[model samples]
Target: MAATHDVTNQVPDLVGHDVAHDPALLESLHRHGAGWAEAELRELGVHAGSAKAQERGRLANENPPNLHTHDRVGHRIDEVEFHPSWHELMEVAVSRGLHAAPWRDERPGAHLARASKLHVWGQVEAGHTCPISMTYAAVPALRHSPELAATYESLLASTRYDPGLGVPAGKSGLIAGMSMTEKQGGSDVRANTTEATPTDSGGHVLVGHKWFTSAPMSDMFLTLAQAPGGLSCFLVPRVLPDGNRNPIRLQRLKNKLGNRSNASAEIEYDGALGWLVGDEGRGVRTIIEMVNNTRLDCVIGAASGMRAGAVRAVHHARHRAAFGSALVDQPLMRNVLADLVVESDAATTIAMRLAAAADRVDDPQEQALRRLGLAVTKYWVCKRGPAHAAEAVECLGGNGYVEDSGMPRVYREAPLLGIWEGSGNVAALDVLRAMAKQPDSVEALFTEIAPVEGADSRLDRAVSEVKKELADFTDAEYRARRVVERMALVLQGAGLVRHGHEAVADAFCASRLEGDGGLAFGTLPVGTDTESIIERARARF
Candidate 1:
């Protein structure tokens, strides 16, 4: 080969490393009482980091899902065809119990363990996790109707990844999707105009168009419609009990910016039969349970992306040289890489803590903490995802912008998490709503942070500022974003101070809480431990 064509300066492809060997992830897993799951987590990590799994993720996204509105004979078959890699990813996720398995398990930290697994495995592919999260979230809402829960809960929790459209009874396992958003009402679901008229058989026929229905190929979906009593929640099956396709018609698949591996479609429910999940007029109340669970996954998804981006950036810096030295050894580059790692570590810490709260369902204080904490954390972490991914991509310079580097996919996927559950405004306002209605939740949040009080003066000041912000609701709506951002920082800081690595906690407190740094990623304070932070974020083979 000519000297000009040589690849001497090229960085090695990052593979064969354990994606789950992350220090922050491991610490959170053990701290949350899920130490028993470490072995399996590592196994999944190894698989996630393997070249085969990475290629699968790439192929799934590159191929994307194609919507078949009609068959060869022109039969109205609203089916979505996906690449085999998509199914493979889905199978691994299901077998790992990253879906509804926690609801079935009686273990102490089942939810936490599941969350940790999701965080680890999600690095392989994020689009498939959309359906997995819906399936997991669907169980909580289905429990509103004991009959429906009895029939499908076990199957949803089953590790078997049974695909295709079939009756719930005939299927060995089930996957679920959610159809809520309409063109008229995005976040304001109460404005939904979909009508659900009652039939004598105790079921309702739905007639409406869903603007955004993700995972359209799933066997069933939990939807909302206007019923006799008022707006209500209902379960709509793709194939009814008689083994015939329902009236769900896929209009077209959305040409989205990212998450192309999963098919999101605009569908028409032409007399689709649906069974009521909860009491009439209680649609929002029932579906919110499912929303809350998926929201937790949103945080997990963002954290997963952050960790992936950070690792890739660090890997590139360590191998590639610049200015007659390795990029990792450069001062400014170290600050940038270390800052990325700190942000990722903080996000992972809080996500695991929220999962821990999810496990303690019976504890009033924990539930209260979750009520308030989840909203603020979701708002801030997801909002930071796009910027973080952008910076991580920048760390790779031109290599990151190219498709082959895999950083572009991370950048594309980051914004979806923030937009999926709720947009930034909606999430921030929810924090205020929880504080207004559930005042005890505020106390629970403070109590959760109390253990780490005085550990870091910056964190202490931030907590005090949060209290001041909460004390006045006069302009709460206007200052919702500002208030929620500070609350999120304080929560993350507290978690780090309580359990995170010393260097991480110090960097986070100094830059994020104390405002000692500039707005960009490479602006950590002078004394920040860049070396230790970058080492923690490096991918381990």
Candidate 2:
């Protein structure tokens, strides 16, 4: 090889490191009462950062799922074929209990433990988590129907990945999907035209189309349709109890911009059998539990992406050089890296806090806080993901724009979280709705922030601003985003002040809450402790 061909300046491959070595994440895990799972978290983190797992992630996306609507014999099969690596990734996720296991676990902080693992392992691949999240979320919704929950809850929570077309009763474990959005309805699920006619067997026959049914290969789906009473939620199985295919038809797979490894299809339920989930005409109320849980995962997913991007940016800067100095040593690069770290830390802190709320279902305050906190956090955190990812990519210069750097995948996956569960407007208005309907949620948010009332003046002022915004509902719908953004920042600032590292909390308060920073990332104020902030975000071997 020629001397010119030497790869002297290139950064080494990031592998064999603990992805869970994050300070904010670990601290929150212990503080939230899941300290016992630290060893397992670290072990999973090692695998998440391994070269083999990285390759699997890459391959799963590179070879996206293929839809086969029919068999060679002209029979309807409606199967989505994926690369072997997809199954490999799903197997690891299921075996580690990242899905529905938390709902059934008797231990405290089980949800927090699951959230921690999802945040860590999600870095390997974001697409596979789609089905995993749905499966985890489906449990709560299933509990709405006692008989159905009794039949499927245990299998859904089982740590076995059984991938095939089979009756739910025969499968060792199950994956679940949600089919709510229709062509005309989108976010307004009440506009759905799917029809569900009651049958004598205590089931309903669904006849309609779902515009976006993610993870179509799952064994079951929770969908919405209009019955005789009104719009209602129903559980539709892929294979019926008598070992026959349900009448659900695969229209075609969506050509999505990202999350390619997960198959989202436009499915037609042609007289598919379904069991009612809740009271008639209360479809939204019944499925809202699943939506909330998945929304929490959306926040966790965004935070995971931010962490991945920040750590990769830091790793690149530490090795790659420019102008006779390592990129990490450069002042401006330090500012950018530290700002990214601050954002990542803030997101991680809030995400863990929400998961802690999930663990305390019996506590009204925690539940109320989660009701309002999840909405605003989901809106702001996910809304910030794309910009955060873009800045992280730029930290790697030209290398990050390319496919192999893995930054492109991170960048692409960012926007999907904001869109999933609910879009920005939907989430923002949901906060307002929660305040109006569940007023306790409003007080709960303030109570959560009260602990750090005078800890940071900037945070205090931000909190006051949020209170004022809430007071004046004049065009509140129009100003929903603004109100929600401030709410999210105050909540994040409070969490950081209460639990995050000193440098992290200070940076977040200064830039995010006080508006001391510029529009883009890397614009933190001059006195910010860039080094300490960036150090905490670096991956450890």
Name the 10 consecutive residues with the lowest summed lDDT in model 1.
1-10
After superposition, candidate 1 runs with Cα above 4 Å error: none
Tell me how far the alpha carbon of residue 31 in candidate 2 is from the true structure, in angstroms, after superposition: 0.5
RMSD of candidate 2 to true structure, Å: 1.0
Total backbone clashes of candidate 1, pairs 3 or more residues apart or in separate chains: 0
Return the lDDT, model 2, position 31. 100
Q: Scored by Cα lDDT, where does model 2 land?
A: 0.95
Name the runs in model 2 displaced over 4 angstroms: none
TM-score for model 1? 0.99
